[model samples]
Target chain A: MVKIYIPADTTACALGADKVAAEVALQAQKRGLDVELKRNGSRGAFWLEPLLEIESGEDRFAFGPVYPGDVAGLLDAGLHESSEHPLFLGRVTDIEWLSRQDRLTFSRAGVIDPLSLDEYRREGGYEGLDKALAMTAGEIVEAVTDSGLRGRGGAAFPTGIKWRTVLNTPSDQKYVTANADEGDSGTFADRLLMEADPFQLIEGMTICALAVDATQGYIYLRSEYPKALQVLNQAIAIAEAANLLGSDICGSGRDFHLQIRVGAGAYICGEETSMLESLEGKRGLVRFKPPLPAIEGLFGEPTVVNNVLTLAAVSTVLAKGAAYYQDYGSGRSRGTLSVQLSGNIRRGGLVEIPFGASLRELVEDFGGGTASGRPVRAIQVGGPLGAYLPESQWDTPLDYEAFTDVGAMLGHGGVVVFDDNVDMLEQARFAMEFCAVESCGKCTPCRIGSVRGVELIDKIGKNDGRSANLELLEALCETMDVGSLCAMGGLTPMPVRSALKHFPGDFERGTGNGIER
Target chain B: MHSSGEAPAVIVSSAVRKFADTPGGLLPLLHEIQAGLGFIPSDSVVTIASGMGLSRAEVHGVISFYHDFRDKPGGQKTIHVCRAEACQAVGSRQLEAHVKTRLGVDYGETTVDGRFTLEPVYCLGNCACGPSVRIADDVFARVDADRFDELLGDI
Candidate 1:
């Protein structure tokens, strides 16, 4: 009997993994081949999606981007053995991209069956929770603080301080909420982690509950991720049955109940306070700070609100010691950065490396430049709100302070590449339009300023008052930057300003070719 | 346009019974009703508000706030095209234009034949493959104008 592996991840399914799986099964049966099929998660090398793996003895041979049409030929070409086929890639681990990545959080991502408890346990899944349960709250917090792990969800806040705040707060009922509402574009690490190895997140959240003395936890996932929702729910149930979660967790007297709450397609809900509001069944509106979710949150009780990556890294921090995790990166940003390479690129996928790597290495070497084969014009780091960097800024290291020095942000580590065909003026306008459409309408600068920002860009594009409109647009960006209550309004100017500064010629050309609404 | 054939009230009551008691259950309740029926009927608001101890205005505000919820029924199928930067970098604008022209309907509008409803999504998280589209639960990647038509034909 031969064992075959195929990915059931959303990206793989989008690329026709399901159809490929069905065809493989049918062909194998018709050919009278003794084959056992297993559905696993993606290996994050998306270019090789629907990546079929055939396990022979100890090693797994790979075939890539396979479709339904490729299955019959694959079976005939000695699919069971490591045969020479057009799609065949040598041993899965030997792929340069997979071999180079320092995968700490995504260690079990594509290696294990997502829902198989036995497989997850074999790969060091719940060992973190076991170690966390043995330590006191202060020791757990100290370990996290020593790891120097900051929030990966854009803000770059210290994770240890947030946990310490929640631990020190006295409350009858506290909460540990994972911000899985990953609304940023060119980013899918949170979704990848949840769908691929959900047990890691569950184990991480359970460890958090043990650290903060929180009784309940909620993963505020966005409505866009239906697959993640299903996988997480199943994983939670499996963990509960195994005594990993519930009233008495893992033979301990403590209780921790976890649930999944789906967001209603609101991007602002990615904000921690807005997530708390949405969890309460209200419109996702941003709240004032100072009562920080740590002191007074989630039903007026203390809470530890963290990003998906932040919480997932907690498992690694506990299982391994703090010093072990802290030794990976440069400066304050420790641990691996999950860089998501997307947009017009020859090879776009997830690249997890330690901090301090240059952006040019990721775009040119790993991404293999543009898919269109045109000269690269710009690169947008972060999301819609992030700045657009020209070729000169590509050498900047991927760190929080390094990106800040270059007037860009490593927001969620999403690097979207664009060729020379792109229109910077148009991209700047879309940034304003996105802010206008998705703004929660809590602040005037974000609410009114964004709409006006769109109009100002339109006027500048048409050359109607040209210089005047440009000045007005700059002033408007400043107002939104300073007056807005949250990053939603404040960060709107980053892209607009960067576009104006780097690609001034696009505005001067005055084609007025605006995107159709 | 009520595709499920069950009364909107029945769907609303069932959803409320399942989620109303839970804290912060309104969003889940709304999702259930939308899943059962095609959309959330305005008449169901009063019932949901009363069940959850909220006002009708509060309920309406929530329904209007979210991009996913709709008060009126849509076409037989809803298609969401990603409009985020990653998709845009690989010609999603061209795909969007083609879809609008082919369907003869703008976003949030159903086709005359009630075959498809066009919607715009920020990101479907399939960033590696540009120009992603979602129909029902399935997401299609690297979709161009031609592939989109082929997908529509299959449906």
Candidate 2:
């Protein structure tokens, strides 16, 4: 029997992996091999997923990010012989990128078929819920606290503290919200996770509901990810059918229901308050603090809002015990982070590793250098709004505190690499333009500042404009940073300033001033 | 906002009615209605407002808010060049300018021939292949101005 495992990660699906699975099944059958084509989650090496694993004597031989058309070539190479092609050149475990990751949340990510609840259970999916069900709510919170799991949504907020607040808050309609709006540029970890092992996210959220005594949860997904929404919705359906969701989850009498809410083309909605606003079917405008979402969220009730990764990690901690998950990472940042490497890079996709891994290892070793093959000049860590660190900062570790200490926030764990050919000035302008377009425009700083930022950057790019406008630009960034209601306006300056600071040479004034033309 | 002055009430039809009751109905409904009926009609605006129990101004604000939603009919073909970070990293700006010069219209404006409408988008998630543009539902990756011509030539 030729049992082939195809990772069900969304990016793999986008690359037509599902069809490849069917092709593998058909091809294997034609070859007279008993083919059990199972769709598993990605192993986080996304560049290598739809990664087809064929069962060998002791272990499964891997080939990857495979396409339906590649099935013939794969078989022609002698599937029975297995280890002789460029596709399966490396050992799956020896890939330092995957090996270094202490995957608590992502444990079942690339292992089991995302759609099959049976495979999910076999790989220890709902074991977290079982463990959480045995413990009291306080014990559940304490275990999570001891695990030292921080929010992977980029905020690095203590997951336990956030849960505890919602737990302690007296409200009949407390909610567990998963910010599946993985809107950050170059980050597809959430989408990959949801597509690969959606049950992990479900199981995680289920455990949260049980721990916090909440009956309802929502996964707010970005509209750009239409396929992920489909996969997640289907997974949710399967979960509900298997008594893993809705009332009496895992037959524990804990009532939890999950609804997938689609985002309407707004990047700011990725933020907690804005997501809440979007969930309420209003404009995705950021709300003021003091009335935190933990106190009054999603129609004026206490809510436990977390990133998809955060909730998914909860399942691992609960299932394998907190200490197991906590054993990885550096001082403050514990556990592995699914870092998404994208942009101008040879190998682009998710790389789940311990929190303290250096950027050098991620970009050079795992990323395999830039797609353009030029010398690496600047790299934008985090998302579009993240800082553009020069090669000097390449050695910095991928941790929340480390990134923050150096004026960069590891927002959503997306590391977008850029080569020497990258024009930082243009990048800064694009950041402003992005914020301007996606801004909910609820606040003036973002609304006006973003538009102004574009104009000012354009002027700076032009040599005729006064250099004094640079100060004006800085002042505008300060105004937006302090005055803006949300990160949409506030953090937009991070990339802009970083671009101007790191690659000032790229921003030099030429003859006509505005682009090379 | 269309000056075609054809029929005024062709905007919000049955599709809008079907989607108006959905959880996140407004945007998709308007997009569907626009796709069916060239523009979001004044009558349909009222229909959407009444069906969704929203104010006409609120509906109008939403229509105006999103660059995607058009109160007027677009040209026969719409060419959206991704002007986002990834696309920019690989010279989409030049390609955009080239397309604009070729079509003789700026961004968000339609061609005089009514053959094309050029717009800017953030990203299509085809980062590995840069300078991407989505000509309607079909995404064209690694698109330069020259490749864009073949795409534009089709329409």
Q: How many steric overlaps are in each model, in order?
A: 0, 5
lDDT of each: 0.91, 0.78
Residue-level lDDT of model 2, residues A227-307, one tens digit each, is: 677789999999899888998876777899998887655677889998887676566778999698888888889998999
Off by over 4 Å in 1: A511-517, B1-5
- What lDDT score goes with residue A314 in model 1? 91
Tens-place lDDT digits, model 1, residues A407-516: 99999999999999899998999999999999999999999999999999888877799888899999999999999988999998999999989888888754444332
Q: What is the TM-score of candidate 1?
A: 0.98
DockQ of 2: 0.25
Question: lDDT of candidate 1 vs native?
Answer: 0.91
Relative to the unseen true structure, what is the C-alpha lDDT of residue B75 in candidate 2, on a scale of 0 to 100?
81
TM-score of each: 0.98, 0.87
